[model samples]
Target: MENENLLKQISFIKEIDKIKYIQRRTKLFNSDRNENDAEHSWHLAMMAIVLAEHANEPVDVLKVLKMVLIHDIVEIDAGDTFIYDTAKDHSNTDEELIAAKRIFGMLPKEQAEEFIAIWEEFEEGKTNEAKFARSMDRFEPLLQNTSNKGGTWAELNVDYQRVYDKKKVINEGSTSIWNYSENLLNECVDKGILKK
Candidate 1:
């Protein structure tokens, strides 16, 4: 049973490597190459750890890290939904839930349950850790876009109202970070990188 569990765990790890190929709409800072799900997840995990102190309410950094790292594994099968893509419909959560079950189920039962629970917690955005994790997920792409001189926002002509609508959740996690982001957004408009 131990060996069986080990094999399942190994298989799950191998399967998640596919996340590296799941490209997102955001580009790397000063680079043309689009970021992938794996890169995004890793970035958010690091942000969760580094920015935990800024969270409005205390959070379990480890839980936030776990939430960010595992939240997008579903994207491996469900495909990435661009936040600003008005043309393409947002990802169907039903499909993503199925993908999560199939992918995380590759692990042993207890481990699979824990991963799914973390993913759901992040999705629900109810707990302090989940809220903070969600903030990191949203904030990272904003930074990427700002760094790339409006990156996808410019290419798509995304406006201030739309950007604000997408990012308001950042305030739930860290008011300091949210304030910084708001300033950056205003700067983007002033610089003509994002539309007013």
Candidate 2:
């Protein structure tokens, strides 16, 4: 039974490597190269460790770290959906749930269930850990865009209101980060990078 579990865990580890190939719209900071899901997840994990103190409420940093690391594994199957893309229904989680099951399900039953729960918590964005995990998700891209002179916002011609609406979730996790993000948005506008 132990060997069976180990094989399943190894299978899951191998499967998750696909996430490295899933490209996102946002580019790396100060670089034109697009970030893949694995890179984004790794960056978010580091951010959660570094910025946990900024969370609105006390959070289990390890839980937050796990959430960030596994949050995007579903993208391996569902593909990367650009947050600013209006045509796509961002509220729909059915596809993501399916992907989550298939990807996380590669592990043993208990481990798979735990990962699914963590991923769902992140999606719900209600708990402090989930909120902080989500904040890292939104915040990383914001910094990337700022570094690239409004990277995705400028390329996609996304307006201020749309960007603000999408980014406001950051406030739910960390008020200070949200304030800084707001200032960054306004600065982008003032600098003629993001459209008002």
Candidate 3:
């Protein structure tokens, strides 16, 4: 029964093997292309580690990494909502919330509650851990856009301002990363990889 709880927890550890990134055909951080969700999660976790010290306050890097790794598991059901998709007609939040409930509920009562709390915490960005996790979350997409030559941004025809507007929540937690992200986005605009 003890192990069953762990097993149940893994039920949400979606293979995502068949699921490709929205920019699956695009490059990764170092210009190596064809990244998948697993690769993306791994990369984001690594990014969180590298940038953890830049957080506004002391943060639990391991917790933030866990948050990053699991944050998109709901996408297993709701599918990825391209960050620029502002259609009130298509709210992935409801579907994601439902999926979160179903997926997190699979674990043992205590474990499920614990992980659900962390997941909810990350969603709310109320704690330092959640804030730092979200900081990495917002930064990863920016890195991908700039690194992969503006794949998602180009696909969505999003402007630089639109990117900033979408990611401004990071400012509430890590002003340093937020400022750096803004500067990087500006550099990307100057290079013309992203639109004005």
Candidate 4:
């Protein structure tokens, strides 16, 4: 049974490597290249570690890290959806849930359940860890867009209000981070990088 579990774990590890190929709409900081799911997850994990102190409520940092890292693994199957995508509903939960089961299901049954639960928690965004994980998710793109002089905002012609509304999720986790992000958004509008 232990050997079978080890094999299942290794298979799951190999399967998740496909996340590196799932390209996101967001560009890298000060670069034209698009970011991939794996990079985004890693960045969010780092953000969880670096910004845990700023969370509005105390969060289990490790759980936050897990949430960030596993949050997008479903993208390996459902594909990356742009947060500001108007044509398609942003909450592609049904498709993502299917993908989540298939991808995380590669693990041992117990491990798969844990991952699915964590993923659901992140999706629900009701707990402190989920809120903070979600904040990091929204915050990273804001920094990237700002660094690239309004990376996707300019390229995609995303409106300032839309960006503001979407990024407001940051406030749920960290008031300080949200305050800074709001200021940055205002600056982008003033600079004509984001349309007012």
TM per candidate comes to 0.96, 0.97, 0.83, 0.97
For 1-196, candidate 3 gives per-residue lDDT tens digits of 8787667657645443434443343357656565666677777799888887788988888888878877776666677665666774223378878977777777678866777677788888889998888777777777777877786787668888888887887886689888888888889888898888
Q: What are the runs in model 2 whose C-alpha is more than 4 Å off?
A: none
> Which residue pairs in model 3 clash with each other?
27-33
Displacement of the residue 165 alpha carbon in candidate 2, Å:
0.6
Off by over 4 Å in 4: none
Q: Ranking under lDDT, best-scoring first?
A: 2, 4, 1, 3
As for model 2, its CA RMSD to the true structure in angstroms is 0.9
- Candidate 3 lowest-lDDT run of ten: 17-26
Query: Candidate 3 vs. truth: CA RMSD?
Result: 3.0
Residue ranges of candidate 3 with Cα displaced over 4 Å: 3-27, 30-34, 88-92
Look at candidate 1 and give me any clashing residue pairs. none
Alpha-carbon RMSD of each model: 1.3, 0.9, 3.0, 0.9
**Model 1 misses residue 91 by how many Å?**
6.1
lDDT tens digits, residue span 109-181, model 1? 9999999898989898889998899899889989999999999988888889999998999999999999999
